[model samples]
Target: MEDILKHNFAAPNQLATIYYMKERVEDGRSYYTFEYGLRTPIYATTSFATLQVMADSLKILQI
Candidate 1:
């Protein structure tokens, strides 16, 4: 799992963080990549915390 933080230019004065996770398959030759982002206004601590909690609780299932 990796976390990256960057500014989001889509909206003015907004900050964004991108999270990436890679899962390898049993074959050792294949893998899966997952990415998500948290976008919020600058200094939005409550919203950022809520998004962080939601992101932490994410589950990836292969079907």
Candidate 2:
């Protein structure tokens, strides 16, 4: 959505945004033991791809 792109996807600033999203989901967001919420896999996959791009950019800079 536009909100995510504007608020969380800015270059240089998106690194922290992506990191925090991953951390929050991993550490705080609870998953049901027997069930799960409606997860749009396409959204999850796209977000991950974006994060991967960010990480790869950082790695290239370190070389």
Candidate 3:
């Protein structure tokens, strides 16, 4: 839902995106990451509530 909403509102030919990656090492160490870009977010975490707000706001555009 979030992805579709973002793409609908994103700049032409520039869709919004979110990325996550994880890596583990032989020493049992691990890393996690989250990445996203497009609309401005009120918080760093970019929770679902924010996405819903964005979606609702885009509805005004009626695209």
Candidate 4:
């Protein structure tokens, strides 16, 4: 089985962040991995709470 979760958040100053997660099951075992990234025009800063919220909102689909 395999599952994926993805989300994106946009902040002020043309800053954007993408969050991704993947889950896989093999041999009766489950594994997971996560990735996140940020994009900006030049330089940008965001609060930790905002990033946490974005991370918290991710949900992997069941299949």
Q: Give me the displacement of residue 26 in model 3, in angstroms.
A: 40
Which pairs in model 4 have colliding backbones? none
lDDT, candidate 1, 1-63, per-residue tens: 322224222244444443454555543333445454444643442112112223235433322
Question: Among these predicted structures, which one has the highest lDDT?
Answer: 4
Which residue ranges in model 4 land beyond 4 Å of their true spot? Answer: 1-18, 37-63
Instruction: Assess candidate 1 and give its TM-score to the true structure.
Output: 0.24
Best by TM-score: 4
Candidate 1: stretches off by over 4 Å: 4-27, 42-63
In order, the Cα lDDT scores of the candidates are: 0.37, 0.27, 0.38, 0.39
lDDT of 3 by residue, 1-63 (tens): 445546554555444556543333434433223344554443232322222123225322121
| Residue 59 displacement in candidate 4 (angstroms) | 20
Point out the worst 10-residue segment of candidate 1 by lDDT.
Answer: 46-55
Query: For residues 1-63, could you state the per-residue lDDT of candidate 4 as single tens digits?
Result: 111111333444443443555566656545454454445767654322111123236333222
For residue 24, model 4's alpha carbon misses the true position, in angstroms, by: 0.5
lDDT of 2 by residue, 1-63 (tens): 234443443343332222223211234333211111122423322233222233224211110
